[model samples]
Target: MDILVTGILLGGTYALIAMGLNLQYGVARIMNLANGEILVAGGYFAFIAYTATQLSPILTIFLVAPLAFALNSLIYRVMLQPLVNRAKSRGQLESDSILATFGLSFIGVGLMLSFFGGDYFSYSFMAVPVEVLGNTYGANRVLSFVMAVLICGALYLWLNRSRAGLSIRAIGTTPASARLVGIDVKALSAFTFALGGAVTAVGGALISTYLTLDASTGVVFTLKALIIVIMGGVGDVRGTIVAALLLGILETLVATLLDPGLTLAAAYVMFLGILLFRPQGLFGKKPT
Candidate 1:
């Protein structure tokens, strides 16, 4: 029971972490390697706000979201758009984006190291214990889970119910067909990319409450997000949430029954299995 509850709580945040990457890669068709850096930056913003102004880290979401959106939009326009325009095919664009964002990740890391130094940062926020199902858990973790669920729920609704979201889905489904239907693929792609960054940053803010983070740790998160996105169907919100939960449960079970150090190895083993057997993802349809 304890493991189940803890895993569910952990998976909730994981869902938020992966959802942004899903949007960027699935909708915008840009495989951003710097996504983890963006998430770390959001955590930094929350840390700064909490330390300097005594502001609640939760409230920092509002500050981080718009800032991340604007910066990401600028990044897409200045750095990625040219690549997008020049690529001869989707494969070429993906290759170019991987290289470009890989460099950007290094730059982001350097800037963070310069400003914050290479030290772990964490803050005591809502550290009180809360009783749940005959067990105790940190109040912050519970709150974070609740917030993640709400945010993901809202995003799902927006994507399924709104016209703009329909267009975004159309592009993700078939970009060429979307273009034929008069969708401004470039502009919308940029928007989706910026929105993905904002979502990722917000996830960082939620996570900072419970996780100790440093400048260089973003890569770990990026890989985790990528794994979740792939394990779930790309662009499939429902699949992302389910895959995250499964991963969370798997990690929890492994850490509790085996060695905590093996949790990451377990994740990799699962990822490998998925790739070998279900490259199209658990929920993704096989290509024709």
Candidate 2:
């Protein structure tokens, strides 16, 4: 029962992470390798804020979100947006993004190592535990789960029900057509990327509270994000949530049943199996 509940909670968290990736890769049509770094950056911001200001963790979002948004905008303006200006498919542009993003990841890791050092760390200041269905869980974990769900829900509403959100999707699917209809593609892309970064910042703050983290956390998180996005499908929101949950549960079960190292390997193998059978992704639209 604990396993089941924990897995469900973890899956919800991964969904938050994946949804942030979706905004960039799915809606903005940018393959952002920096997605994970953005998450960690947010985490670090919260960490520093907690240490310096003694502010409540929940209040940290106000500062973290804006900083993350600005940093994301800078990254796009410098690295990604240039590749986007050239006429090319996602494959071509993503190739460049991969290299740039990986480089960014490496640099970020190096900087963190230089400044923060190599140490396994966690913050437990704002902890609160709760009981559900005769099961007990961390208050921080519950808060994290609730925050993830609320942010994702709000984002879905914005994208699906709001005019701006509809415009974001329309522009990504066919920018040429959207432009012909007078949508501001450049502004929209920046806005979407910033919004995605803000969401990731929230995820990052949750990470600081829930997991032991260091400079290398971003690298692993990025790979995990990749698995979720690929399994979920490129540019599919619903697919991402389902995929993150499935992977989250599967990973949890595997860790329980087998050696820890083998768990990731097994998950990758499962991912490959799914890709072989349904390359368009489970919830992805069939290619034309």
Candidate 3:
């Protein structure tokens, strides 16, 4: 029972992170290896804000989103845009993005280590324990879960209902067709990346309140997000959330029933099983 509750809370954070990746990699078809680094940057932004101003961390969370958006937009303009413009094929562009973003991740880690050092940082939430179904849990975890749901739900609505959202989806489906139809593919793509960054940053800020963070800690999150995104199928936003929660439950259950040290390995095992049985992903449609 305890594990289930805990896993649900953890799942909320994972969903946010994975959802952002789904928008960038799954929808845009851009393998952003630095997605995790961007998440870390968001956390660091909140951390810096809290430290410098001694303000409420919750307020700082709002601030991190725009900072992340701007940062990713800058990255898109400088590194990704030129490559995207010149690429001969989608396959080649995706390959290049993977390598380029992978290098960018390392750069992010190096810069963070230099400035923040290799130390773990966390914030005190001063939250009290709340009882749910006779089980006690931290209030902060509950808050994180609620926030994740609300934010993701709002995003889901925007994507399904808004005109700009339709444009984003159209580009993802067939960029050339979208372009011919008058959608500014490049501009919308950049906006999608920026939006992805903002979403990830919000997740990061929530995560900092939940875990001890270091410059290198975000790689684990990166892997987890990738796994969930793959499990949910590329570009399937709702599926990503569902998969993240399920993975979290499975990981927590395994850790509780077996050895805690096996949790990470268990997640990989699940990933492998999914790939072996459903290469198109759990929610992905079969390719013709």
Tell me how many clashing residue pairs each candidate has: 0, 2, 0
How would the candidate models be sorted by TM-score, starting from the highest? 1, 3, 2
Which pairs clash in the backbone of model 3? none
Best by TM-score: 1
Per-candidate Cα lDDT values, in order, are 0.94, 0.79, 0.86
Identify the superior model by lDDT, candidate 2 or candidate 3.
3
Model 2, global lDDT: 0.79
Give the higher-TM-score candidate: 2 or 3.
3
TM-score against truth, every candidate: 0.98, 0.93, 0.96
Q: Give one digit per residue, the lDDT tens place, for model 2 in 173-285.
A: 88779888779989898888877777777888876777778877786777777788888887677788888878877887878888666757866876798778988888777
Q: Write the per-residue lDDT of candidate 3 for residues 100-139, one digit (tens) a residue.
A: 9989999999999999999988877746899988999888
Report the C-alpha lDDT of model 1 over 68-90, residue by residue, as the tens digit. Answer: 99999999999999999999999
Worst 10-residue lDDT window for candidate 3 reads: 49-58
Tell me the lDDT of model 3 at 104: 95
